[model samples]
Target: MKNWFVALGGVLGYFALIFLYTLGAYLLVRSPPWFRYLFGFSSLSIFFGLLARTFHWASVAHIVLAESILIGGGTLFSLFWAFFSKKRPDPGGGAQRSPEERPGKSDSPATFLPAEGGDEEADLPVSRVREEIGTLLDAGLSVLVYGPTGSGKTSGVLMECLRERQAGDAERSILLISCSDGMEDYDLLNRPVPASPQEKARTLRAMAREHPDVRIGSLSRLFGDWDRAEGPLRSAFRRAAGGERLTIVFDELNRSSVSALNLILKVMDPVLGHYELFDFTTGERLSCPLDRLVFCATCNMGEGYGQTRELDWSLLDRFPGVVFMDYDARLEKQMLMDLGVPPDLAGRMVHVALALREAHRTGNLAAPLSTRHLKNWGRLVADGADPENIAPCLWVNRLVSHDRLGFPDKDQVHGIREVLGRTFRGGRKS
Candidate 1:
């Protein structure tokens, strides 16, 4: 009885020691490929060695000794093989497919790598503000289209005008200028003159000299000169007052410097019908064109993504027609579907975006997920990338999250994983 009990204890102890050793080995390596190889070879060796022991051809002590040695040896070989092995696939990151390797390239309605930039001008069909723009502008008010990036605010304005122009609305010209910091009067005006006052005078004079019929108006003529006649600053108003209707696009107004924006404010007073522009050379009242012109401005929230400045209430009051562009989950999903994103994956990506947006509502995120990100995810899906593998790259990394935004790195990652897991496979509805 004592001998049988001793043998039973010895057998259990030996098995426990071997299990502990294998578990410890795997935990130390903690690499999936290494663990796989280590366990594979070790298990096969142990199985063959145990078969010999079962046949009474080998002793239990010998079997244990041999199995331990084989597992240790397998562990070393696995480590060596793993060092040269390719990395395990990371579900949340990486560009696994190239442009040619991506599906539907030969017969698809879309060709885009999302997250890089505009998806063919915001996929114009889904735009909703076109019809309302004409009415808004006709009200004698400057219009402000405010929204997230890629919500199509700038494109909405231009596309509507382009369609009108193509349909023979040729009298009016649609001019677009992207606004940014340190934007000078020359860039805004698109004048044929240099930035320096000397160069500006020289260029204007040279042009006048070349055209013998033209008068190179004096500095006095363009300046307080303003009290006598309009200066060059009221350029837009001058055109408007001259009965030449124009649509001026102020793209990304928030990105412009305060001085640049203040320049716009001078000319954007609808009630006064004009703004006072100081002489570029003299810094005095140059001219005021009192004819109200069509001015359209697009604004992004600019909290995280770009350089932004708050607008003066006085300047903002000029635009009574303010439209907030919000992303439509349904429209976005439909867009991806039209672009050949499979229905199931498109639906999932949309849900993911919706979830991110909802999470933003809770103030967990500094920026809401843009429809642009959804399109990106859908593009990847259409290209045969798994959602789980692509979501981290397309979704989390795309967030405007940073330490300054109050979300720590771990928290941001955690939040992203929680949201993705719930929406993708955890069976939680967005």
Candidate 2:
């Protein structure tokens, strides 16, 4: 009896330890960077202490443990402070729109809010992009907005949806699917997920009903197995068919693999009323209908964007509303000025961006400075960081690759450096 009890306790302890480790790993992966770093530091410190005890290296262990604790603690505290201390800008009032101007039942026209320097109309490109998206939604067609990185393609679609939510469209559901080259067909259809307690109870009840001869207690233990959950694409389709207005946004759509895209093509067809998916649980084909589903995707194509393939015409043909967006220098400059950057400095930053774009076009540089980069540069300048000093880090380093000598690409870096120097001349004398 004693031996059996010992064996049972050991088995339970082993399983409990495994469960804790698995749960910790799952949460650690999704935790923020600073938390991850702190965890790593603690793990390393324990490892070093164990090694030191085995080898009797007391002094070295002490120094290392002290340094790790100080550095890790300081990093964690600083990240916490910065996160809490940063002031968030207020969400200004949005322009009111009547119901006649609304696009679909869920998606409404984006409201251009008032800005400091000028009225809302001054932000032309953003408003125009939003209007275009609203118009596409109104036509009952899927929208695909393609542009360079950081050109606000995704934001334009999101802003339109946000306006709907703000306008009391509570029934609207926005399902965001972030596409990548490694994504699988099953990732977009359905996959096995850990079953919740409620789901397990429901499954147990169903099993009991199917097999009236078996006891529910015996079947309950087997309910620990994972349950299948539909992926975002299938779930959105199901909800839309069930009378819910679903906005499915596939971000970085061009980065998805050919297989994933092919699977998606079946359901993306507007003419096709239904798409089929194999149900392993029921051993049958489940046909899901498409209704009230507004499909939207953001694609980053052209040069400078790696790990992205050219979209096939078959995939492109599914989207009737395709909008091409690019960096708008005028709007970018106005935004920078609004961020408290001096007008002259803001203009010069845009000039630098244009020069880099020209270099990229001429094949002299691998990538151009985007408006996002300009905003960062402008912010740093506004904070009193020397533009010329930080230029190498803020943009130049990003545009060039390290050579065999472990230095930034000599020719490309030199060209960007020249552009920065010329653009920031006498501007940094303050």
Candidate 3:
């Protein structure tokens, strides 16, 4: 009975040491990939050392021999697990099939596998806000979509418009302008065009005949290049005025200059029904009617977006249809699975993203994991890259890079590492 109790005590003590070691490592360790082995080697060494001290079970030589034997066995098993275990297929579940293979399912994760010679664009992850945008466009109302980065505002809307345009009418014109801080009124309305040799000579002769007293320096005006070319905006306006269906998409509208915004406002004035495009070279204004025109703009308006202007309230009022897009958990997970990530793995990725987004909301994190990041992560994981190995490069560094406090917010980074360790531990292998 005494021997039995001593044996029980030994087992309990060893396990207790293991628990403490695991907890400490989890809380303190930065690199999780190597932490498990570190815990195992250190805990076994300590436990064996303690047993030898307390029970006088073995001499130093004997203890060293036992440790070597046990550690060698563990090392061999680890090698087997690393090199051979992965060759076997998963018994729990068969291979995942593409969405088209399974029908009557619209709500589940649609694993998109394009057929031979299939169109990949047709398989893009569908956004919920797309329907609303379509409804507004059909009603002849302009749309404004405001959302966080990577919420699929620009790509989703642009793809949907392009698809619709291709399917419905090839003659319908679509114009996409990615607005920037440097965008000016002239950049939108019109721009100078280099004059051809013949045109320049003709203009110079006509100017000389009309204003012979004009100085040689004033002859520079005879070059006549200003507003000779119509920009995307003007070209779309003219096409819409000519009874062709037109869709104009302005991406990152908040980044546009004040002059560009004012120009947009004037051009979208519904009461006027017709807007004038100035010909700077000829001093003429051509009136273009607004017919069959649909305008849409996307803006990123929140923290972590630098150099973005607060949109004018008047401009916001012009959009009869407004959508606030955000990351859709179900859709995002579906997208991951579609990219060939295991369902369980996809779920965990979405969970981490949601947790990070909450942290961002509370100002604990500078930015959250975006759909773009998740897609990239998913593709790598699907291709057999270890999630734990690539996470630091893909997810962790990205969050740390944008930390407003500094390049790496240590406290925040520690928190992120902890979250990742907790979530990714024992995760599905691929």
- The numbered model that scores best in lDDT is 3
Report the Cα lDDT for candidate 2.
0.68
Estimate every model's Cα lDDT from 0 to 1: 0.62, 0.68, 0.70
> What stretches of model 1 exceed 4 Å from their correct place?
1-134, 138-140, 156-168, 190-243, 270-292, 302-306, 400-408, 426-430
Ranking by TM-score: 3, 2, 1
**Model 2 lDDT, residue 79, Cα:** 82
Cα misplacement distance, residue 352 of candidate 1 (Å): 1.0
Residue 74 in model 2: lDDT: 65
TM-score of each: 0.52, 0.59, 0.60
lDDT against true structure, model 1: 0.62
lDDT of 3 by residue, 134-204 (tens): 77776667889888889777785545755675477676567789899998878776766678877776777
lDDT of 1 by residue, 230-308 (tens): 3233555456556665667788887787767777886675345345455454344433344334677888765555577
Clashing pairs in 2: none
Ranking by lDDT: 3, 2, 1
Q: Output the better candidate (2/3) by TM-score.
A: 3
Winning model by TM-score: 3
Tell me each candidate's RMSD, in Å, in order.
Answer: 18.6, 21.1, 17.8
